[model samples]
Target: MKICVFGNSHTACLIEAWRAVRLGGEMDFFVQAGTGPAGMQLADGRIEPESARHRAFLERLGLPVRLDLTHYDALAVVGCGISKFRLTDVLNCCHVLGWPCPNPSDLPVITEPCLRAALSDALAGTTGASLVRRLRAARADVPVFAIPQPAPSERLLKMRCTGGGFRRLIRQGLALHAAEVFRQVARAVCSAEGAVFLPQPDATMTHGILTTGSFSTAATRLVDLKTPHPDQDILHANGAYGAVVLEALQAALRQGGKPCIPR
Candidate 1:
C-alpha cells in the first residue's frame, strides 16, 4: 500500500513505527512535516504543500508539491491542528481536571455534553479538519483518515509543559478519565467534518492517557541523533507506538474495505 502522511513532528514516530513493524515492502510511505496548519493548503483547485521547509521535506521524501494523490492507495492526515498535549497547562488550564480543582485531592467531574463542548471549542478551527475537507472536495472518492496526535506520556508531570498544580491531579487518574472524554469529543469533531477519526491504539496506552513505557521515549527525529536519551521529551511516542497505530489503521481499512470515509 502506498500511503502519504501529512503531519507535524508526530509523523516521525509514525514513520519509526512503520519501520518497526517491517512494513517497508507491504506499505510505502511518503511523509511531509509542517509546523502546523501552515504546511498544507488548497490553491487554484489543487492541493499544495504550503511551507517551504515542508515542500523541501516532501521532495527529500521523493514526493514533490505537485505529486499526484491518485497514485497513492490511501492518505493518512496526522497531527495538523491536533495538540499533542491537550491538557497542558497553557491550553486547558480552565478544564484540566474537567473542572477547576484548586486542590489535587479534590475530585473533579465533567458531564459528557460539557466535555464535548469544550473539545469542540478547543478544536474548532483545526488544520486537520480543514485539510480533510479540501482533500475530500478535490477527491471525494479517495479514502482519507485523520489521526490525532498521541496523548502525553505518564512522564507528562515531569515535563516543563505541564504545570505543577495540574501534574498532581493528573496522577490521581484524572488524566486518564479526561483522555476518554477528549477522545470522544475528537471523534465527534472528525465525524462532523466527514473524516474517519482513528484514536491512538489501546495497547500503546497504559492508563488510557499515559503512553506505555516501551513507547514512551520521544522520537529522536526531534533532537540530534547523538542524544542517547531525551531529558525532556514527554510528547512524542517511540516506534512501538507507531506500530500499534499502523496495525489499527490496517484493521480499520480492512473493516471498511474501500469505502472507509464516512459520508
Candidate 2:
C-alpha cells in the first residue's frame, strides 16, 4: 500500500527509518517545519508546497510537487505542533477533576466536560486538524491517520520543565487516566474529521508520559540530517522509534483497532 505523510522536523526520524527499511515505492513524505499554518490546503484536490522552503525541502527529499490523496492508499499527518503532550501544558496551569495537579488544593479544578470542550476547540483550529479534514474531503476513500508528536524522553527527567508533569502525575496515582482521556479525545476529534488518531507505541514511553531513552537518543533534524538534536532535546525520536511507528501504523491499518491508550 502507498502512504503519503506530512510533518515537521520530527518527520526526519521517519525519513531516516524509511531509508533504512528501504520502502522504496511504498512511502512518500513532505516536511514543513514551524508553527505557522499559512500555506497547506487543497487546491483542486491537490496539495503543493506552501513556500520556497517547503518546495526545496520536498525536492531534496525527492517527493512529488503536488500531493494527490487519491493516488495513495493512506495519508497521515504527524507532529508539526500536534501531540498528546499538549495536555501537560494544560495540566501545568489548571487541571480536570481527576487530573494530577501539582498543587491540587491551590489550583482550580475543571470538569472533564470542560477539558474535552477545550480540547475539541483547540483541535478545531490546529493545522493538523485542518489538513486531515481537507485530506478526507479531497478523498473520502483513503484512510487517514493522525499521529501526535511523541512524548518527551525520560532522560528529560533531568529538567524541570519537561519532567515535572510526569513526576507529578505519576506521584498522584492513576496517571494513565488523564492519558487515556487524552487518547479518547484525540480519537474522537480525529474521527470527526474522518481520520484515526494513533497513540504513541506503548514500549516507547515510561510512566505513561516520558519516552524511553532507547527511542529518543540521537535524533536528527529534518532540515539538516547531520545535526543531532541537542542532549536536552526531548521531543524528537530516533530512527528506531520511527521504525516502530511505521510498524504500528501498518498493524493498526491491518487490525483497524480502536484508539485505546496502552496501560
Candidate 3:
C-alpha cells in the first residue's frame, strides 16, 4: 500500500531502513529539520510545505514540498516532539500518587489525575499534536499513525538529559509506571483527534523508558544517512529500530497479526 510519512530529522532512521529493505508498495517521506513542525500545513486537504523555510531540505532530498494526500492509503508521523521524554521534567523532580518516590524533591505532591492533565496539556501543544488537529479538521479519511521520538539510549544514563531524576525513577521501580503513564496520555491525545499513537517498540527499549544501546550506536543523521550520529548522542535510534517500528506499523495498519500499537 502507498503511505506518506512526515516528520523532522527522525524520519531519517525510517528512510535508512526503507532504503536497505524497501517496502513492497510505496512510501514517501517528508522531513523538516529539528523538533518544531513549522512552515507546513494541511492546506486544502493537501500536504503543503510552502512556509517552511527548510523546504530546501525536502527539495535537496528529492521529496515533495506539496503532496496530494489522496494518492496515499495511510499517513505516518514520526518524532515531532510527541515523546515520553517530554515527561522527564516531571518524572525527575516531582512525586505523584502511587509512585512512592521517597523525598522526590521538596516539591508539592501531585496526584495522578493532575499529572495526566499536565501530560495531556503538554502533548497538545506539540508539533505532532498540531498536525493531528489539522488532519481532524480536514477530515482526512486515511489511517493515521503517530510515532513518538525513540527513547534515549541506555548509554546516556549518566548524561544530563538522562539525569538523576530518571535514575531515581528507575531505582524506585517506577520506570515502567512513568513510561506507561506517558503512553496512555499520548495515545489519548492523539486518539481524541483521530490518530493512532505508536510508542517505541519493545525490542528497542531497556529500563522501560530508555532505548537499547544497539539502536543508538552508529545511528545516522536524517538528511545525511551516510554520516554517523555523534558517539555521545543518545536521542536517536538506528535503522534497525526504525525497521522494527515499521513492521509494527504495518501490522497495525494491516490488522492481520500481532499489532504493536494496542487497541
Candidate 4:
C-alpha cells in the first residue's frame, strides 16, 4: 500500500510512526507541509516557501523536491493550527497556553470575525482547498483517512507560561493550537462524507507526565533531543502513540475499506 500524508511536522511524525510499524516494504509514504520539523523546501533552504528557519531545516532533512502520489493507497491529513481554520477568537480566549496572544494583551482586542477573515485570507490559494476538492473527487473510489493531532506536551504548556521566555514559544504554541483546530476540521470533513476519522488516543498519560515533571526521563528515553529541530519535542510521537495510531488505522481498514490514496 502507498500513503500520501499532506500537512506539516505532525504529518511527518505520523509517517515516521507508520514506517516503524510497516514491515516487508508493504507500504509507501509521502508527506507535505502542515507544521513542525518536516516539510518541503524552497530554493533558499526553507521548508515551505515562507520562513527562513523552515527552509534551513528542510535542507537539514534532505527531503526531495517532489513526491509522486499517483500510486498511493491512502492519504492521511494531519492536524493544522487554529489560525489555519480562521478561528483565532476561540483560541485567543480559551487556549490553555494563551494562544493567538503572543502578547497576552492582544487577546482582549482581537475580535472573532477579524480572526476568521484573517484565516480565510491565509488559506486562500493554498493546498488546503485543493486537497478538499481532491478528496471529494476521489471519495467514491479511494479510502481517505484523517488523523487528529495529539494533545500538547505538558512541558510545552509550561513553557508558554514563561511569557515567551523561550525564543520560539509563540511559534510552538501557535502550531499546537493549529493542530487542535485541524483535528476538528478534518473530523468534520470526513464525517460529512462518510469517511473515517481515526480517534486520537487519550493523551492524559502524556499530559500527566508533563504535569508531574516526568518529561526529563521521557524525553531522554523517547525523544531525540539532539536533533536540529529540538523545538519539536511537542510534536514527536513516541513508540506507544505511534502504535496506537497504527492500530486504529488497521482497525479502520479491517472494516473492508481500502486505504485512502490517490488513483
Q: Which candidate is the best by lDDT?
A: 3
lDDT of each candidate versus the true structure: 0.62, 0.75, 0.78, 0.44
lDDT of 4 at 200: 66
Candidate 4: Cα lDDT at 74: 58
Q: Which candidate model has the greater TM-score, 1 or 4?
A: 1
What's each prediction's TM-score? 0.78, 0.89, 0.91, 0.52
**Lowest lDDT block of 10, candidate 2:** 254-263
On a 0 to 100 scale, what is the lDDT of residue 216 in model 2?
A: 96
lDDT (10s digit) by residue, model 4, range 1-263: 55555554445544455556673224433333444223333232112324565445444544433444445565555554312223433444433343443554543444434444444444322344344334435444567665644444546655554323222324544544454444455455455444456656544233212211232213221122223235445544444465566667666666865633331
**Candidate 1 vs candidate 2: which has greater TM-score?**
2
Evaluated at residue 166, the lDDT of candidate 4 is 23
Which pairs in model 3 have colliding backbones?
none
TM-score of 4: 0.52
lDDT of 3 at 114: 87
Window of ten residues with lowest summed lDDT in model 3: 254-263
lDDT of 3 by residue, 1-263 (tens): 88888888787888888888986778988778787455576667787774645677677777777887778877888889888767877655567866666762577778899888888888887888777666555545677888998877888677764456566677788889889998999989888767888888888999987889988788888766678888888778889988988888887778832212322
User: Model 4 — which ten-residue stretch has the worst lDDT?
Assistant: 208-217
Regions more than 4 Å wrong, model 4: 23-25, 33-70, 82-91, 94-130, 138-140, 160-186, 193-195, 203-235, 258-263
Which 10 consecutive positions of candidate 1 have the poorest summed lDDT? Answer: 220-229
